[model samples]
Target: MEDINLTIQKGEFAAIVGPSGCGKSTILRMIAGLETPDTGEVLAEQEIIQRPSPDRMMIFQEHALYPWLTVEENVGFGLELKSVSKSERKTRVESVLKKVGLDGFQSYYPSQLSGGMRQLGLAV
Candidate 1:
């Protein structure tokens, strides 16, 4: 992974593909601020990423939603952590759920939803 210079434009999706242990996850971890490069820097939007940020998230292929929380709770968890007002959080969560076609499933738990629905819940 030495001298790896990559630029991912905003709104542009990129994928890193390679054999196992070839540092693909390491690169993603660096970008997510979960790991630090010993010799180089990882930047997002021109800012050096030194810690985990709400603006940046790593949603693994597996289900990452909290099993104990309902869909609405899982979707609003980040906003809750940021101290967003309850009303605002509700509004935003409802908006996102509506957009994702999960508006009526807010009370459902992760295990209750289908695989695709669970993934969408995680994405929200």
Candidate 2:
């Protein structure tokens, strides 16, 4: 992973593909602020990423949502951890649900959603 220089623009999508143990997950972890580089630095929005941030996230391949929690609950889990106001959490959850076409399925559990829906919930 030496001398790796990459920039992902806002609204742009990028993928890191390589054989196993090729540092793909390492790079993602650094960007997510879960890990730090030994020498260089990782920056997001022109600010050094010193720790995990609410604005940065990583969605793994497997379903990460809690099966017992409803769609809205799972989507708002992070906000809940941050101690966001319940009213604001609800509003933001609703907005994101609508954006991902899961607006009316807020009460549905993860098991009730299809694979694609579960994946979208992860992104939410």
Candidate 3:
């Protein structure tokens, strides 16, 4: 990896393009706090990233999945880990799913969904 500096402000879309395995994802992981730099800093606002948090979310190139969980369960998994109640989690998860164009496939498993739906599932 070479030294590079870039800033993406709030309400903006930023894409990194380069050859495969050229540390494109490495940069995102550092920003998302999934990986630490050997030296230097990764900050969200004024806070230094140290670990994964809801405030700093990441969805990788590969569709992230809990193989044993259903579509609904996978979408709601984050809130579940935070100990949110079932009713509220359900409500939020459903809303998010719908926003990502998954309006009626909640009960489907990952195996039953198409690649696009699986990607949509991960987005929710």
Candidate 4:
């Protein structure tokens, strides 16, 4: 990797548009702590990026929604892994599903959603 410099402050929305295999996803993965750099660093809150944390999240071009999980299940997947409580998880999953326009489809599986819907599901 070259010495590429990038930064995004809180509440910022930045897009790294690029052709296929041009490292856009690589950069994102690195920033998400999914990939490590050989000769550089990734910092979050002034600390070096180490591994996946709730404070940082990533949604790839290919939706990572689990096939067997219902829409609600997938949206709350992360919080579930973190052992969030039932009511809190339900509230969060519902809120995000509504935010992504999947409010009525929470019981559906990824296989039932269109590509865009799946992408939205992954995003939330």
Candidate 5:
């Protein structure tokens, strides 16, 4: 974590790679505002990130979905929180689930889905 500096272009597909316990998750959390740094700053889209932005989303490693909510509900939870209309939420949920190759599992609960399927819930 010494003097780390990174830059990503608009269309870049970048990833963080490191050994376990080597600060990979730390970096992500700091950028995502889930953790704070004693020094240095985390910026996104030219803005200093002081807190999590609604426009920026993080798919936690824990999946973080309510077990009682179905796949579609979990994926659309953010939109729901934003007070998006029911029809629009439904449309977006379906579209994102399909984008993640989960065309037929919208009705599935988190417990009923595989781990990878649960992870796809965050793609929305």
Candidate 6:
């Protein structure tokens, strides 16, 4: 995590390569706004990131979606944070869930879903 400098252009794909314990996840976490740097600031779209925003999302290696909420609820959560109207959120969530092939499982909780299904939920 020492003096790492990088710039990823819009629509570009990037990779962080290193051996174990090299703080690669740390860098991604900072970029995802889940962690704050000790000194330098993190910016996206020319704006300094001071805290977590709904605009910034990352699918963690683990199933990070709420187990208490159903699939539809989980997908709609993002739109809800943006102040999207209830009906619009419902429609968008339903569309995304269906797009991810989770249509019939909208009422299912995380514990009821398989590993692949859980990952799909994050993508919603």
Which numbered prediction scores highest in TM-score against the true structure?
A: 2
**Residue 119 of candidate 4: its Cα lDDT?**
85
| Best model number under lDDT | 2
lDDT per residue (tens digit) for residues 12-118 in model 1: 98999999999999998898889899997999988999998978877677998999999999999999999999999999999999988999999999989999999
- Using TM-score as the yardstick, the better of models 1 and 2 is 2
- Candidate 4, residues 1-124: lDDT per residue as tens digits? 4878998998898989888888888888988899998888999989999898867778767778889999999888889999999899999999888876889998999999999999888777
lDDT of each: 0.91, 0.93, 0.85, 0.88, 0.83, 0.86
Each prediction's TM-score versus the true structure: 0.71, 0.76, 0.72, 0.67, 0.68, 0.68
RMSD values for the candidates in order, in angstroms, are 3.0, 2.6, 2.9, 3.3, 3.2, 3.7
Query: Candidate 2, which segments miss by more than 4 Å at Cα?
Result: 10-12, 78-88
Order of candidate numbers by lDDT, starting with the best:
2, 1, 4, 6, 3, 5
Per-residue alpha-carbon lDDT of model 5 for 27-113, expressed as tens digits?
888777777777888888888888876656667787788999988888888889999999999998888788779979989899998
lDDT for model 6, please. 0.86
C-alpha lDDT (0 to 100) for residue 72 of candidate 3 = 88
Clashing pairs in 5: none
User: What's the true lDDT of residue 69 in model 1?
Assistant: 96
Task: Give the worst 10-residue stretch by lDDT in candidate 3.
Answer: 52-61
lDDT for each residue of candidate 3 in 11-117, tens digit (9 for 90 to 100):
99999999998999999898878899888888888788899776776776797787789888999998999999999999998898888888798888898899888
Give the lDDT of residue 11 in candidate 2.
100
Can you give the lDDT of residue 88 in candidate 2? 100
Candidate 6's TM-score reads 0.68
